[model samples]
Structures are given as structure tokens and as C-alpha cells.
Target: MEDFLQNLLNGIAAGSIYALIALGYTMVYGVLKLINFAHGDIFMIGSFVGFYAGRYMARHATGEAASLGSAALVLLLAMLVCGIVGYLNERIAYRPLRNAPRIASLITAIGVSFLLEYGGQMVFGPDPKFFPTLVEKKIIHLGTITTTNYQFIVLAVAIVFMGLLQYIIYGTKFGRALRAVSFNFETASLMGIPTDRIISMTFVLGSMLAAVAGILYGLSYPKIDPLMGIMPGLKAFVAAVLGGIGNVPGAVVGGLLIGIIESFVGGSQFSSYRDGIAFVILIVILLFRPSGLFGRYEPEKV
Candidate 1:
């Protein structure tokens, strides 16, 4: 029982990161109907950004405030850099292909992913770097289960971001414009909505979420690498699909579910299969319930 609880806590922490990254996938799909495969790379970039920012701040500080405050400031810095990268992605690689076939955009996304991956190697070097400690680590004991404050920190920050996103999606003019653009670009344009800008803004919002995930993951694991985004990116995609590709709340549920299941599986003797479980879930979800657990079936008219 204690073991189960421990694994659950670990899973939730991991799932929160997955959910943050998955939001990027689902949101871009919601508006542009294009998957930004390079988003994972953006998350990777954010980690490196946080790595440097955290270290710089750490060096400048003298005491306790260095830990928490430094983390917060570093998070903002990473998000800002990643948000710019997301905007550039939309402006450069994707904007020209807006009127092109979906396949063209899809191929371009893959191209962008490759460019960032290899480009990251060129810029950040092809080696893994230790994520500098921004927060002092302490064990948090929950009865018989053991964890750390980082778990709670991850969950708390993720919730705050999700809440802000909910407000943005449902409580603002941009949200309405985004919804309109997603519903019908031509009609939204006819109604004076700047569809292009809305689409680009969507990418920025999603990418910032990825940045948050990247920083949180680095804090937990204390390792940053150029190619680190690949597997987590794929699994987060699976979570997005499992929760309904374009459904906002569904992405959160799917991420937690994937994380919980993967955690339980890893705790068992099937630890060797931890990485494969996500794909298996993907296959099962696709085969039986492509509409996703939270998604309603919408018939596409041909």
C-alpha cells in the first residue's frame, strides 16, 4: 500500500509535466490544425534557458531567497525565450505554408523539428548538462511513503498555469477570438477577427506551457540534454490523443492517467517495459476509442 502511494505521487509529478507539454500539442491542433512537432524542441530549449538562468541567479544570490525566487524568475525567463521561439516558428516556417496543403505543413513541422534538434546540438552542444539546483532539496514524508517538495511544487505550479489557461480560454476576448478562428477561419476573418494572429498566439501560449514543463522536469531530474525532449514529447502527444487531441481539459486528464499507469507498471517487475507502456496505451486508445475518453464523436463530412 505504501509502495502504491509512493508510485502514485511520483506518477502525478511526471504526469503534470506531460500535461504541460501535451497542452501545446492539443492547442496548436485546435487552432491551426497543425501539429508543431518542434514544440518538444522548444521545451528542450527552455530547459537550457532555465539551466543558465538558474545558475546565473544562483551565483548572484547570497541566501534562502535564492532558491524559490530564483526558480520563479528563471521560469519566467525560460518561458519568454521559448515563447519567442514559438512565435518565430509560426512566423517563419509555418506562415508561408498556411495556404498550402496540410501535408506540406505537416512535412514542414517535421522539418522544423529536425532543424531545432540538430540546431540545438550545434548551439548547446550534443552533451547532457547537469541542471543547477535552484531549490534546496528536502525529503517530504507522507506517512509511510516518501517523496520531495519538488513533487508538490510541480503539481502546484501546473495547477496555477492550468487555471490561468482556463481563464484565458474562457474568460477573455482573445479566447473568444481563438474559438472563433478555430471554428471557422473564413467566418472569423469575415467578422474582423485576425485569424493569423490568433493562430500565432495559440502557438505562443502552448509553447510557454512547454517551457514550464521543461523547467519543472529539469528541476526534478536535474539533467538537461539536447535530445531530452523526444520521448517525453511522444508520450505527451499520446496523452493529447488519449484525452482528445483538441480538447483542453481532456489533455490534463490524459496526462495524469498516462503518468499513473506508467508509474504502476514501472513499480512492478515490468520496469523494463516502462517506456513501451505509453505506446501500448496509444495503440489501444487509437484502436478502440479514437474519439478519446473525453472527446465526443464528431463526424467529418466528406
Candidate 2:
């Protein structure tokens, strides 16, 4: 039972990160109907940004007194940088292909993914760097289960951001415009909405969420590399699909489910196959419900 509880806690922590990244996927898909494959690379860049920022803070701080504040600042900087990168990615690579065939945009996204990966290797080197410890490590005991402050921090930050997102989507004028554009671009444009600007804003918001996940991931694992986003990105993609690709709340549910499954599998003898579990779930979900768990089925008219 203790082991089960431990695994559950671990699952929630990892799931929170997956949820954050999955939100990025869902948001972009909701708005543009295009999968931004380069999003993972944006996440990688955010981690590197946090890496440098954290290191700089560590160097200048007198002691642990300023660690938490420094970590918050690093998160903000990383998000800002990634948001800009996402904006450029949309403008330079995706915008031109808006009217092109879907295949063209898909291929472009893949090309951009590769470009970022190789470019990152050249700039940051292929070697992995250890993430600076932003907060002192301390274990919290809850009955039979033990967890870390880092886990709590990850969960807290994720909840806060998700709440903010919910408010933005449901309560803001910009969000209404975003939804309008997503529903029908031509109609929205005719209604005086700036379709182009809304699309760019979507990318920026998604990228910022990815950036949050990246920083939280670094804090949890403390080791990062240029290609670090690949597996997590894929898994997060699966989570997005599992929950209903364009559904915001679905992404969160799917991420938690995937993380819990992975954690349970890892705790068992089938640990070696943990990585494959996500794909297996993806396959099962696709087979049973192509529209996804949370997605409503829409019939195509001939």
C-alpha cells in the first residue's frame, strides 16, 4: 500500500508536467488545426533558458534565502523567451503555409522540428547539462507515503497556471476572439477579428505553457539536453489525443492517466516496457474511440 501511494504521488508529479505540455498541443490544434511538431523544441529551448537563468541566480545569491524567488524569476524569463520563439515559428514557418495543403504544413512542421534539434545541438552542444538546484530538497511524509517539496511545487505551479488559463479562455475578450477565429476563420475575419494576430497569440500562449513544463521538468530531473523534449513531447502528444485533441480539460485528464499508468508499470516487473506503455495506450484509445475519450464524434457529410 505504501509503495502504491508512493507511485501515485510520483505519477501525479510527472502527470502535471505532461498536462502542461499537452495544453500547448491542444491549444494550437484547437486554433489552427495544425500540430506544431516544433513545440517540443520550444520546450527544450525553455529548459536551456531556465538552466542559464538558474545558474546565474545561484551565482549571485548569498544563500538559500533567495532560491525560491530566483526560481520564479527564471521561470518568467524562460516563458518569455519561449513565447517569442513560438511567435517567430508561427510567423516564419506556419503562416505562409496557411492556405497550402495540409501535407505541406505538416512537412514544414517536421522540418522545423529537425532544424531546431540540430541547431540546438550546434549551439548548446550535444552534451547534457545538470540543472542547478533551485530549491533545497526536503522530503515530506504523509502517513506511509513520502514525497518531496519539489513535487508539491510542481503541482502548485501547474494548478495556478491552469486556473489562469481557464479564466483567460472563459472570461476574457481576447479569448472570445480566439474562439471565434478557431470556429471559422473567414467568418471571424469578416466580423472584424484579427485572425492572423489571434493565431500568433495562440502560439505564444501554448509555448509559454510548454516553457512552464520544461522548467518544472528540469527541477524534477535536474539533467537536461538539447534533445530532451523528444520522448516527453511524444507522450504529451499522446495525452492530448487521448483526452480529445482540441479539448482543454481533456488534456489534463489524459496526462494524469498516462502518468499514473507509467508509474504503476514502472513499479512492477515490466519496468523495461514503461516507455512503450504510452504508445500502447495511444493505440488502444485510437482503436476503441478514434474521436478520443473526451471528444464528441462528428459525422462527416458526403
Candidate 3:
């Protein structure tokens, strides 16, 4: 039971990262009906941003606590940088293909993905860089299960960000406009909503979330490379699909489920197949219920 609890905690921590990235995927799909495959690369870029920011702050900080406090600033900078990158991605690569076939946009996204990966390698180098330890690590005992301060911190930050997102999506006027645009682009535009700006906002918001995820992920794993985003990105995509691709709440649920499942698998003898578990779940879910757990099927009008 103690072991089980430990694995569960571990699952939740990892799941928070997956959920964060998945939210980006779901939001973009909700608005554009297009997958920004380069989003994972945006995540990678955010990690590097945090890496440099954290390292620089650590050098100037007076103490461990001060260095840790710098994490908030690091997070803000990463969000701003990646947000701009996402905005540019939409404007330069995705906007032109809006009227074209879906395949064209998909191929363009893939092309962009390659561009970010190789471009990142050229810019940041192919070697893996160690993430600076911004937060001091301490172990906490909860009954029979032991956990770290870092895990709790990661979970807490993720929840805060998710709550803020919920408020933005459901509480604000801009959010109402965003939802309006997502529902029907032409109708929303006719209703005097600036559809283009809303779409750009969607990208900006999603990328910001991804940036936070990237920073949290770096804190957890501590090693990052240009290609690090690929696996996590794919798994997060599975989570999005599992929970109904365009459904916001569903993305969170799916992320937690996938994270818990992965943790359990890792704890067992089949640990070697931990990465493959996502694909298995993806295939199984696709076969049994293609619309996903929370998604209702809609047939095309002939």
C-alpha cells in the first residue's frame, strides 16, 4: 500500500506536466481545428529559456531561498518568449494555409516541427544541458509514503496555472470572444469579433501554458535537449485524444490518467515498456471509442 501511494504521487507529478502540454493541444484544436505539431518544440524552447534564466539568477543570488524565488521570474520570461514564438508560428506558418486543405496545414506543421528541432540543435547545440536546481530539494514523509518538496511544488504550480486558465476561459470577456470564435469562425467574424486576433491569442495562451510545463518538467527531470519534447509531446497528444481532443476539462482528466498509468507501469516489472504504454492506450482507445471518453461523435453531413 505504501508503494502504491508512492507511485500514485509520482504519477500525479508527471501527469501535471502532461496535462499542461495537453491543454495547449486541446485549445489550439478547439479554435483552429488544426494541430500545432510544433507546439512540442515550443515546449523545448521554453525549457532552454528557463535553463538560461535559472542559471543566470543562481549565479547572482545571495542564498538558496533567493535563487528559488527567482523561479517565478524565470517562468514569466519563458512564458513571454514562447508566447511570442507561438504567435509568430501562427502568423507565419499557419495563417497562410488557413484556407487550404487540412493536409497542407498538417504537412506545414510537420515541416515546422522539423525546423524547430534542427534549428534548436543548431542554436542550442545537440548536447544535453543540465537544468539548474532552482528549488532546494527536501524529503517529506507522509505516513508510509515519502515524497519531495519538488514534487509538491510542481503539482502546486500546475494547479495554479490550470485554475488561472479556467478563469480566463470562462470568466473573461476575451475568453467569451475566444469561445465565440471557436464555435464558428465565419459567424463570429460576422458578429464583429476579430477572429484573427482571437486565434493569435489562442496560440499565445497555449504556448504560455506549454512554457510553464517546460519549466516544471526541467525542474523534475533536470536534463534537457532539443529533442526532449518529442516523447512527452506525443504522450500529451494521446492524453488530449483520450479525453476528447477539444474538451478542456477532459484534457486534464486524461493527463492524470495517463500519468498514473505510466507511473504504475514503471513501478512494475514491465518498466521497459513505459514509453510504449501510451501508444497501447492510444490504440485501445481508438479501437473501442474513437470519439474519446468525454467526446460525442458527430457524423459529417453528406
What are the TM-scores, per candidate, against the unseen true structure?
Answer: 0.98, 0.97, 0.98
Candidates' C-alpha lDDT:
0.91, 0.92, 0.93
Clashing pairs in 1: none
Cα deviation of 35, candidate 1, in Å: 1.5
Per-residue CA lDDT of model 1 for 1-302, tens digit only, reads: 89999999999999999999999999998888787889889999999999989888888986887678878999999999999999999999999999998889999999999898899999999989999888888898888998998999999999999999999999999998988888788999999998889988998999999999999999999878889988889999999999998899999999998899999999999999999999999999989999898887877655
Who is ahead in lDDT, 1 or 3?
3
* Number of backbone collisions per candidate: 0, 0, 0
Give every collision pair in model 2. Answer: none
Provide the lDDT at 241 for model 1. 92
| Candidate 3 residue-wise lDDT, 1-302, digit = tens | 98899999999999999999999999999998888899888999999999999999988886866866798889999999999999999999999999998889999999999999999999999999999988888999999899999899989999999999999999999999988888789999999999999999999999999999999999999999999989888999999999988889988998999999999999999999999999999999999987789977866445
lDDT for 160 in candidate 3 is 99
Quote the RMSD, in angstroms, for model 2. 1.2
- Candidate 2, 30: how far from true, in Å? 0.6
Model 1, position 275, has a per-residue lDDT of 95
Tell me the spans in candidate 1 whose CA falls farther than 4 Å from its real position: none
Q: Candidate 2 vs candidate 3: which has greater lDDT?
A: 3
